[model samples]
Target: MLKLENITKRYELKKKTVYAVNNVNMTFHKGEFVSILGLSGSGKTTLVSQLGGLDQPSEGRIIVNGVDTSSFKQQDWNNYRKNNIGFVFQDFHLIAHLTAKENIEIALSLSGLTPKEKSDRAEELLALMGITEQRDQLPKQLSGGQKQRVAIARALSNKPDIILADEPTGALDPDTSVQIMEILQALAENGHLVIMVTHNKYLARDYSTRIVALESGKIISNEEVRPSKQYKDDQLSTDKSSLQFFTAVKIAMNNLKIRKKSTIFSMVSLIPSMVLIFGIMNLIFNMSGYKADFKPLLGDVLGKDNLLYVTPFEDEQLESTQKTIYKEVNRLNVYNPRIEPFKNTIIEPYTDDAISDMEDIEGVDKVLRNTYFDVIIDEKPFLLMALPPKAYASYQYGVPKKHYPEDHEEGIIMSSEAAKVLLQDNHASVKHLVGTDITFNIYNYKSAAIKLPSIMEEKNVIHTKVIDIMDISTKTKLMSNYHAGYIYVSYGYAESLRERFDLDDFTLFSYSVPDPFKSVVGVEVEGGFLITGPQLVADPLRHLRIKTSLQEKYNLFQFREFDLNMRGNNYSVKHTVILNDAFNKDSLAKLKEYGHVTKSRFDAYSVESAKKTNEYINYSLLSATLIAVVVILIPTLLVCVILYVSIILRTKEIGILKSIGARNKDILNIFTMESGILALSSGIISLVVALPLIQYVRNILESEYDLQASLGSNPMDYNMLGIITAFILSVGIITMIGLLPGRKASKLQPNTLLKHE
Candidate 1:
């Protein structure tokens, strides 16, 4: 039962009020076929909308089963429309994308029936409407009368208490109109209230047990032609159902199918972003050399961290205001122990006592002392490093397989580049250079600091046999100018030259240190100690005894000068101390009592510096990736805007769905799912298309850049996780963009939407 008490609906045009329905009072009972007949603009439709709860009257209360619905919320109104009333529009507003049976099933989806039950119910209703043969046919494929029958069946799907038909047969032929009216009359006979609004008097007169006439905004007449047959009311079913997730997905897929061109276009729009993201990730992985099997060439040169380099220095002072002041040095100066003139000329080389003291350090595995000097070979200056024959055996870069140099032998090893420079005319192969005699001229720095070029005094001339020519590319880090020329000779020959020149015995003692990256120990020199590991730039020595003892033993009170053949004007008394792999910070501090200590070329001390450099590189890469994402957003933003406009254009369809028992959340799910589907489809297709393109690009790079070994050599090189992450992120963002329009469409009233349609 439904009742209207003084219901009024008003509209304002140009500041003048016009009433669509005014002061209407009526009541209708179950099992009644009631017809409201009026000319156009007679408020019949507005009154029906008020009864159906699709629109609220401006002034009055609609009473259903003795409950006033005037103050009902929007959700309550929706529930009322869903469970209590069914609507039939003039144009048969069935979803264009669904078949006749599917359209009915959509309404049945709110019946709380299982999927199979809903299917069975839809078939039964379709058969009852005499359109069972057209169940699988779309709305456009059906005849106009068939479409109207399907619309009526869908209206009956929920088993509502009231059927509100707005011109149910307005577009049908006379015979079809008769058939439609008979259906309504049968529903009334079956204990359901059927109300129809029509402009045709003949149809109304034939179908009605009661007739109500309206003129302008007021009801002019109400009359009963015959007493309606009284029947026991068939109670409307109260079961409720919600939109399931899979059902939502199916509905979304159907919508996408109906709009094929738009969906394809959306998918195609995402390809470029996907390809660029994948390609960049691949490049980063390759450049970082992340393969498990790859090892750096530096590892071969460093030889497992068992060597250390030690350089000694002399302290300096200046008199200021009649007081002695010790001068500080720059910490960042990688080259330390500045060599100066005469104040401290002679370097007290590490004696047997000093060597014993160094070997006594905590982690001293073995100590090998060597002397290095600058010599002239064939009028070209080259660095000459002299070490014992045993030390030569430990050389990482090059050691002769045959004819190895002995301790007392006069054999020398020269870099291939240095030999080429020295023997310009007769520079043959390494085998030819072997057994060839080469002379080295050593300057007498112990003579005097001459003011002018009076006569450069030559201290000693030594002739030696060339035993080997080595390639020094792997030892580049050991040289100040990595590509500079150099030579290697035995310690006995160097000692003989030193004796003849009357020069200071500048011995270099080396040992090893442990955990090279974390060690902070160094021997105390003039101003500061030479750091053993590359981890630190320059840190002051912590032990005072080591500093004081080193200063006293090395006679390092003032800086000294030495004449280096190739090295222009810089001077210092340099000594080296080697450490085994067992040295710790304490061992390094103990060594500081002798002289400034540094790690040798073969140590792993530079690992820390390399790690820091990698960290900066990673940060730069992250910044680049962020910039790339922002660039990708340009197109993503465009897609979002387009999707919003597309949703806004479908407001009428949204209203139709709501009228058919779809809740706001259901409406929201439909649109958001559509966007997600678009994003996912695009992402998947783009990834599929990118794999071959990436391979092709890799091939091109390998051939063009000669990087075959570096580009695609590893099988575990794809960015699968990154690709999946991008897809999810893209779908989420697009779904969020659809929310504003989806919510707006869902909140719209059915009557307002139908009026526009």
Candidate 2:
């Protein structure tokens, strides 16, 4: 059944020649009971390994059933081992986790037998070996002789025609050795060839039909105590196709079998992968979170129209902010307007027909009259206006400054803080101020208080009922300063005062392009001057105060340097100067433009701080995520090293498979299958624990952050793409690790290995 012809195997030592198997020549016939007798390092194990196709000669050919087994590819050799050859090691190398029955079943399963068949054959093999009663017990629970019996059962699972035993009874007592020898002799008598290598000459002489001898890694002699018979592969019941598949699976099983500890070590090495995935997912969630900011809120308030907010410059040049605003501006859609001066606060045309002409333009909602003055409130000055009450909603700070002073009148609202100062002494609160009488004095009016000097009041004063005092500083800074205080009466009240005072040189008329925030649907004003002197620009700035005052005091409606934005609808203003505030988000954007205005709120807060905050959020998240990936890289590398060492450790077994005809792909499949199983299973377990681990670590460190964190409380949204990313990265990383050993395994000299084994 097994024959070696002038087989020579050698190894190089430092300046020394060594022969592991030297010129070994031997023959074993079918049903031959043979033992190759030698001491340790006597080339006995090497010669037996060759007989089993676990090794090949460096200098001679090996024949099994008249086939030159040395010429077989890895796959062919593997097939030969699975169906034609059986091996029994001295150590009883049974898998610890599998039961005694299951240990045999593992062999049958790799032989491509169906589950039912594997179980039946496992039972049959055990029964034949007289270990049927111990089938249910694990290897650890079995005695030495019993374990050897189970191993013999496993070797018989494939129904091989020949069995090669390497010191099969080495670990057993003399009694157990005799028992094992008896079993081998019985199998040989049953027309199966059994060859063994051992140091026990008495046993070999007593049981083997033939005996061969070797010494110092060289074959010394060969003899037949009993007559040899021709051998055949008739005992193998498996077909070629079944054997091929079984060969593949058998090689695959070796990855798990021979590298058990390394597989476990490799599995436990994935902890960092688990931790990294959790941290990365968390960083993504954190980066996606955001709080409401004024810029976006202003966008909601103004719609899609491009609005530029400009106020009195502090550190920035007025023109520079204008350029900055225009730079970021999409000129085509926003129509990019710039700050320009106006000729008049009021247009003069006292006649009804002239007023009708002012009302005729398709673009001009009105060329109505307007006036500006600085009024003293809480002893501080605020921009005040005498305009039609219906048009008063255009003030920049009016939304935040809108307040109804106390004491009922025809109609009126005062800035909240301003009203507080007026109804009290030294800005003190007046509990009864809401309904109390309030007064105003004018130099050119009748109710200006008779005996004025005596009472220290003006003569032409006129007053109206105060409606309600309100806090309008919720969205703007105007009310935070005492200057927001004002005494606002209706535009009609101003008209009557002008009539009663016999006013002259005043024409309360609106001009071109007003309303700083609402740019479209308003008259066009022009700007291209570079006026330098303070006094020269002061009057224009005073006329421009309508724009500048709102620019400084409030940011209710957003603007860039020289743009206004409005959308939706505009209603006639009544009491509230903040008519846009009264509307919902949509309606507010369509706010009506006043006949005159300018940019009022750009660069209001810390632009640098906002920029810094944005940068910090983005870069911080990215850096943390990258660092985590790098940190987790250590375990991945460890797994690779572990797998590589495992492959090297099993070099001798790999050679065994190659001699039997496994392929490079077959070898790779085995290793990859082993690593792939561990990686995939560990990946699934890690992913399952990802979010919880994140939460656990977060809870563990929650006290460290200034903000509250709860692991985002969202399901991990891993899709096919993410899984594929992980698989590709893991395989790529691991394949690189497995490559060197895999190449070495692929390049194994099968003929040389067979002789050396």
Candidate 3:
């Protein structure tokens, strides 16, 4: 039974009050086809809406089965609509994306029925409505009569107690209207309370067992044409209504499929942001992954864990300040150490005593020193790297042992670039030139510094056989030991040359300084007095004695005005100590006291200066990563806007769902899942495209700028951590932004949304 006690639905229009449904009392029983007949705007539709629980009565009680619904909550009303009443709208109100059967199943999806049970119930209802063959067709594919039949089937799918039809045949032809009225007449005969609101008086009178006429928001007549039959009460299901998660997903996917062009456009629009985010995140990882840079090389050729890169620590001064001072000296273009007292300059060297003390440490290992100096190969300038015999024992740069120098053979290994220059053939391979002899012309600092150009002769030349050639490929390009434009030779040969030619003792002076040569070298002029002049050569032994005396007396190594640091630069000549076994943290700490030590090359020692430098680098990398995040947010905000537009477009569909018992949470779920899918798909596609792009860019940097080491020890490698982080950040940002539109959609009222254009 259903009853309305003085139900009134009022509206305030600017300054006047209008009643869509005025105070009226009515009652209806089972097996009754009640037709509320009225013209347009006579409150017949409003009365039906109140009975169906689509809109609450503004000022009265709606009693169902002797119980008042005036105090019912929103959820209770939803349950009432889902379990006690079913709606048949004039426009059919079918979701365009769903098939006829699916439209019926959607109502069942909110119930506690199993998926198979829901499917069976939907198919049975379609068969009952005589639309079984059209069950798989969408609303747009069906004719008006078939669409109305599908709508009627969906309403009957839930087996609700009351069926409310508001102008159900308003859009149908005369014959189809007769068929729909017969269906409603049958439903009333099957022990159902059927309430029909329509303006067609002829159809209403023909189908109804009782007729109620209304005018001006008030009922004018209530007449029973036939006696109401008493039928047994059928207990309706009271399960709590909810939209399943997978059902929501299906609905969202269908929506996307219907608007596939816009969905694809949205996904493509986010690709650039995704690529930028991935690339910049990788760069940040490369900048900070110093240890990982060497993992491949160390594991393949040079053993990891025990190797250490060492540089002499002169004092506690900042390394940046020291680099600045060294750069100032480099500007002078002086290559000889003696010319500017650069050997024992501001930076101190590891003395023999200090080296012996290091050897005596608790975790002492073999120490091999490397020497770097400039040499002229034939007529071309080249840098020569002299390594000790023990240092040459490892197969450096993948070169086989056949190319290594034999014991005391005085052989040299040439770089491919250097060999290309010497042979005057860029396309020729240096591998064939192995075992060939090459001549190196050493610079005579004394001869060049004393203004004697003619004396620069072949007497200073040294001949050595080429034992091997190193190709500067990207594989080993980042290692300082395998730098291009250099020659590798034994340290013993360099030591023999040093002693044979007295290379460290050659000194020079400029006339620009006070007492250019006389005060420093003590040159006596023809007047029997020491005087400053450009052309003055005293005894080599006496000049050395005076230099040593000045070094001891004033510690003049620090006081040299023109302290040129060419041959003594750390990059040119440095020592690398490799531990035979892995050492602990304490042992590494002890080694730092003797020299700058790191597990990998280019890694700074863990001192205050190095820590400060690393801090700045980390800050810069973080800023770059944040900038990437902000850049990606551009597309994320666009996704938010797109989802908002999508919500606006689906307002009617949302209202249809709500009318069929979909909760606010269900609407929110559908939108959020759509956003998540969009973001995840964009992220995956972007990463797929970005990987190859990263390698291509790295190759350009290495070939054009020689920046392999600046990026990482291995420029072609990828960081998985960076890739994962980029994906998570991009997806999370987009999904969170999408929630804004989802929340807005959830807050909308079903009545307003159903009326949305």
List, residue by residue over 363-478, the lDDT tens digit for candidate 2.
32443333223223333323344544444334333443234222122444555656655645545653445554554433211111112131133433335445555554321111
Q: Residue 79 of model 1: what lDDT?
A: 73
lDDT (C-alpha) at residue 613 in model 3: 33
Tens-digit per-residue lDDT, 222-316, candidate 3: 99887767876655445678998788889988887888988899888988888888888877776556323233333422235656655564323
Taken over the whole model, the C-alpha lDDT of each candidate is: 0.63, 0.52, 0.68
Clashes of 1: 19
lDDT for 102 (candidate 1): 89
Scored by lDDT, model 1 comes in at: 0.63
Count of clashing residue pairs in every prediction: 19, 48, 0
lDDT of 2 at 128: 89
| Number of the top-ranking candidate, with lDDT as the measure | 3
Q: Rank the candidates by lDDT, best first.
A: 3, 1, 2
Query: How close to the true structure is residue 642 of candidate 1, measured as C-alpha lDDT?
Result: 62
Which has the higher TM-score value, candidate number 1 or candidate number 2? 1
lDDT of 1 by residue, 1-757 (tens): 6888999999999999999999999988888989999999999998998888778999998888777888887767767777878888888888888899988888877666788998999999999999999999999999889999998998898888789999999999989989999999999888788999999887788779899999887999998866887755444433443566766788889878877877777766666776665566554444344221112323322334656544354222112210210122233332234432322433334565777878888777555554555455665655676655565466433545353466666667876766765666434565578778877654222221111111123444566778777754422111112224457777677666555533222211111244423322345544333333221011111011122332344322111112221111123333444456678989888877775554422222233333333444466467657765774676567666666766656666776777876778888888778777777776677677767777788667556543323222332235455456555666566667667666766777888877664
For each candidate, what TM-score against the reference?
0.58, 0.50, 0.59
